[model samples]
Target: MAVPVPRQRDTPATESAQATPPAVAHATAPQASLTLLVIEDDPAGGLTVPEILDADRHRIRLRTARNLTEAARLLTQDVHCILLDLSLAGTPGGSGPGAGPGTAGAGTAVADQLAILREVLRIAPRHAVLVLTAEADAERAAEAVRVGAQDFLFRDELDGRLLSRAIRYAVERKRADIAQYKLAESKLRAQENARLERGLLPNPLLEGSDLRFAARYRPGRSRALLGGDFYDTVRTPDGTVHAMIGDVCGHGPDEAALGVELRIAWRALTLAGLCGDDLLSTLQEVLEVERPCEEIFATLCTVDISPDGRRAGLCLAGHPAPLISRPGRRAQLLPYENSGPALGLLPKARWPRRQVELGGAWSLMLYTDGLIEGRIGEGRERLGQDGMVEMINRHLDRGLSGEGLLEASVTEARRLNGGELTDDVAVVLLSRTDG
Candidate 1:
């Protein structure tokens, strides 16, 4: 986006009123100091560029480079403009015999010097370039401008006012180019991040079931796409449906990456015909290897509902138990006795799976701790398990189900806390009947 126009002295006819060209335009407004690099081969300093004193006495700072080698070393970001001599072609030591154009063997040297100019342009594409050449060689001067220079100046007519004006224009152009490039890069990065977030969060896969899945997750880290909360559901080969939700500790790209690793492991283990303790034990090993630190852990609740829709086996690893409610029945916590520590805590922790006999028609809710830990009042005590059950009973009385129920619970949690949740929350509902 930053297209730097180099300077070249190659006009077909003189544009100045007299035999010499008029002074280049000066900045209408005062501007900041600028660093300029003058690349020339005249060892005797035959080329008299403007000093601090222009014909009108405007001051300008200047640095000199004899050839491409010096220019390369001085090509820092601070250098605003480069005045390159068309004759001094390649790097100093690298030049061999026959380097210059006029000499019987200088043809290669001339081409090499031109190559040096090309390389300099490649390196400092953001800086303005000016080509200095003899007035007689108008053809090469025009060619130089065509190559990359912004404006060309004849050595014989060079003065303070023209050089100063050229430097100011070059710097302004470079800044515009940089600004445009940054804006384009920002837009591209935002688009890519949005695509990734979509893949990470997906709609529930329970199309045929009466279940309603609702969830909300926000990363504790700033400007992040996803945290470590993950959930998934699948109907097995035998028609039994399995569902799970888990939270990896911390809010970081590493934590999110680990969550993906564990979720994929859980799916693979489930489809491979592993379930209950065996599936979870292998998952613990997976986390032990994949987690960024030993202190990292994950809490998970997995539910395997039978095809008949009358029974389900719930497994917990340091996770809150799922809440259950039947038509005309009070909501209560599912049996959570003998649960195990979260993954990556103990080398051999045991999670005794609990079996619950769901009615012919009932709804079950599983969630991460973020849902229950919000404050109910301006006090230390949290909503906790009991508070959540009471909240669900009230919602059921209003006949809320599926997405509506999940939305109500989350909205109420925020209201109780008086702010957004600080931790990630994931909720999944499984129902056996529409009633």
Candidate 2:
């Protein structure tokens, strides 16, 4: 490392040496200053590098390390690439190439020959590496690439121009490879999230039921489709329609998954003929078991519409009361007296179900707090339940109903909040047009 290193253009090639590509350097020369770290037993003249200029005609700075220890000390973020000598003997210990460390001496010849290369890769996972070996060891040079090296170079074929070009090429190729890997990983994650979102937002099992159903859902997390909000609607065999909306304590993945579980359990329990306090108790039990933590709880509102589609049994577990909008009457909150504590909070909580009369035609709007808790404007004032009622009245005056009404309400909430809401929102509309 202390001796005079070979400089390609300055050093005369032997008559038997292969001709080097003079144009490769000009094409691959890095635009900015590039540092090359050379690790070898003898950098004094093992390979040409001292005063070797890059293809850009800029001087390629060089750092020499006699061993792995010295190389690590010199390995800095500024080091763009590494030129490792494959023939370099193992460190004083039998821990590197030429000396076996982990495995026995059976068929580890390839591993042994590339031990130093592997060590370099371990220490510098981000650095572009180029292996220096004899031209006869072509297969091993390629194996080094498969082992995570950026590229490999033969000592006989290496010159100032070839080394410079290889360095630039290896660095760019490594960068491209990293970008490609991230793109692939993002695609896989998006696919998985899509599948989860579909499971969370289930299709209502109202095939033979006459009640109309519409829902709007949005997650709080950026680039996320599913958060802590969950909802489901299903019709029992007896012709009764069951709809439920709930929000977990947190918006993290654990909370979102738990919400989905509760919604599914509610649907299953409803279809199994469970209703009123019995259904609510079973749901609370499921929440206690499925929640990620003891402190985590969920606010839920479940309504079971009678077979006549005019009356519904309402149960609020620390949730907002549903808004009832009739043909000739103003929209208002339903009776929420004696509502029980949120699930996972009380051990033997009793959610008293209230029988409500739904005249001839009515629209029951069930939603989580996310819809009304958003800031009304830049001020600290929120679009609370009162504000939500006024907003709904305005939309209704415009004749918006079903999907249009839900979409407009949520859109207006976001606009009033100044941007996207910080919490997940889930709204469900159960409308019956017949008297």
**Cα RMSDs, all models:** 8.5, 7.2
Error of 2 at 215 (Å): 2.4
Alpha carbon lDDT at 403, candidate 2: 100
Per-residue error at 137 for model 1, in Å? 7.9
Q: Which run of 10 residues does model 2 get worst, by summed lDDT?
A: 11-20
lDDT per residue as tens, model 2, 62-165: 77776677778889898889988876653222234444365455245555546667778888988889988878878988988888888888888778878888
Q: Score every model by TM-score.
A: 0.65, 0.82
Clashing pairs in 2: 6-48
Q: For this target, which candidate reaches the highest TM-score against the unseen true structure?
A: 2
Query: What is the alpha-carbon RMSD of candidate 1 to the true structure?
Result: 8.5
The count of backbone overlaps in candidate 1 is: 21
Count clashing residue pairs per candidate. 21, 1
Best by lDDT: 2
The regions of model 1 sitting more than 4 angstroms off are 1-42, 46-169, 194-204, 250-254, 289-296, 308-311, 323-335, 357-365, 369-435
